[model samples]
Target chain A: DQQVKQNSPSLSVQEGRISILNCDYTNSMFDYFLWYKKYPAEGPTFLISISSIKDKNEDGRFTVFLNKSAKHLSLHIVPSQPGDSAVYFCAAGKGGSNYKLTFGKGTLLTVNP
Target chain B: GAGVSQSPSNKVTEKGKDVELRCDPISGHTALYWYRQSLGQGLEFLIYFQGNSAPDKSGLPSDRFSAERTGGSVSTLTIQRTQQEDSAVYLCASSSRAGLNTEAFFGQGTRLTVV
Candidate 1:
């Protein structure tokens, strides 16, 4: 079963504009969420993350909003740059099992110059 | 001084052959994990190891797949009697701790193809 889902396979946005990527999860046991960005021929790197205790977490130009009621979360990048183009994977894990994460298929985001 | 490093950047073997992929995690990171990414499977968790703890092998797909971490530093994933389904990029990751949702650093990955 697809516990974590990224419904959109691809997304496109203009540079310097705001970009939003969405993800949903079916597992209520998950209390922690993370977003990872990956470029071609590289591994996914952690971008930002949020805990279920808070509704939002922000760092610099990146902010992650969590809506526990909706079982959804989103990553927002302001003043998007061409370098932001990559595949983003949403991951979920509970405190147990040493935080073994379950990840989505990933969304390919393209920032146009 | 370094991040996770995986060796044999690429590997090709015939069916029923055996293959070994190695990973060197960042110094002092005690938690390690192995995952496989295939076109058909997307990405699947295979195994995990934490310092002096029994690995969680629940994600391992079959009896043909196995992994070992020695001295809590380097890990090796071994596949015996490989099948075409084993073709995929095998990735290794490490974190500073076992829990608390630590940020994981991934290796460049070893691409393994079973012909």
Candidate 2:
């Protein structure tokens, strides 16, 4: 069973535009969510995360919004740049002892210059 | 290394042969994990080790797959009698602690191809 799902396989956006990536989870027990960005032949790099208690978390140009009731989360990059083109994976995990994360299939975002 | 390191970046093995993949976690990190990623598929959890606690092998797919962490530093994942379906990128990650709040750093991954 896919606990986390990223329905969109790929997305394209023009440079300087906002890029939004969405993710949904079936497991309500997950209290923490994370986003990772990966390039070809490279491991994923941690982008940002949010706690279920909060609705949003922002760092620089990247922002993550979480809706506990909807079991959905999204990553928004304002004024997207070409360097932002990569595959992004959304992951969910519980806060306590269980550190294992359930990840979505991933969404490939291409920022066109 | 400053980050997690996995060796044998690419390995091609014949079916029925056994393969061993290695991982070196960041120094002083006590938590380690293994995951598999198939083409167009999401990362699949394999196993986890935290300090002296019993390793969590619940995510292992089959009995043929096993892993060991010696001295709580380096880890080895062994696959016996590999099958074509076993071909995938094996990724290793390590964190300062075992918790959702800590970020896990991942290695470049070892790509295995069973022919």
Among these predicted structures, which one has the highest lDDT?
A: 2
TM-score of 1: 0.94
Clash count per candidate: 0, 0
Q: What is the C-alpha RMSD of each candidate to the true structure, in Å?
A: 1.7, 1.5
Model 2: CA > 4 A from native: A95-98, B100-103
> Candidate 1: which stretches are off by over 4 Å?
A96-98, B40-42, B99-103
- Could you tell me which residue pairs clash in candidate 1? none
lDDT of 2 by residue, A1-113 (tens): 89999999999999999999999999989988989898999888789988888999999999999999999999999989999999999988875434678889999999999
CA lDDT of every candidate:
0.88, 0.91
- What are the fnat scores of the candidates, in the order listed? 0.42, 0.49
Which candidate number maximizes TM-score?
2
For residue A108, model 1's alpha carbon misses the true position, in angstroms, by: 0.9
**B10-97: candidate 1 lDDT, tens digit per residue:** 9999999999999999999988989888873446788999999899999899999999999999999999999998999999989897
Clashes of 2: 0
